[model samples]
Target: MTAKYPNKEHVTYATFLSSNRREKVDGVEIGTQFTKVVVNHPLQENEELVRPMKHCKTIGDVHSEGTSIAWPSICIQKING
Candidate 1:
């Protein structure tokens, strides 16, 4: 998704299933779920946004082939888990 900043900066995201109960995909849930997204020591000049409360995306402004709750490729489209 192209962001409204600059001429045109497509702000893609790395989706993930962090404790969020999304639809059953093809992979199994692993490790610990994500809770808080820690910010740098000094706030950078970048916009940090979670896709949505339902389907949460990890970091914005990234470019990937998209993921799911199965693969857990860094994956969530459901509400609370």
Candidate 2:
């Protein structure tokens, strides 16, 4: 299967579910149907890199209304490299 975020730096197991659909397997809900099957390539060590964003802080006076800041966006990278 193709990676979810192909342009991304890392490859993860969850990436396989990108273009998949929901289905029921043996009365249990599972992944998508077999649209196509592709051979899984051998994963290399340190083949992929994921640079995740860490903590972020805003410098301002807490009691000052105008000096405060809003919430920031967070990106968490799950590495399977």
Return the top candidate by lDDT: 1
lDDT per residue (tens digit) for residues 1-81 in model 1: 223222234333223334445333333323343322222121222433333223433332222223332222232223254
Clashes in predicted model 1? 4
Model 2 over residues 1-81: C-alpha lDDT tens digits? 122223433221222222233433223333333221111232322232221112212111211222111211121133477
lDDT of 2 at 18: 24
Q: Please, what is the whole-model Cα lDDT of each candidate in the order they appear?
A: 0.30, 0.23
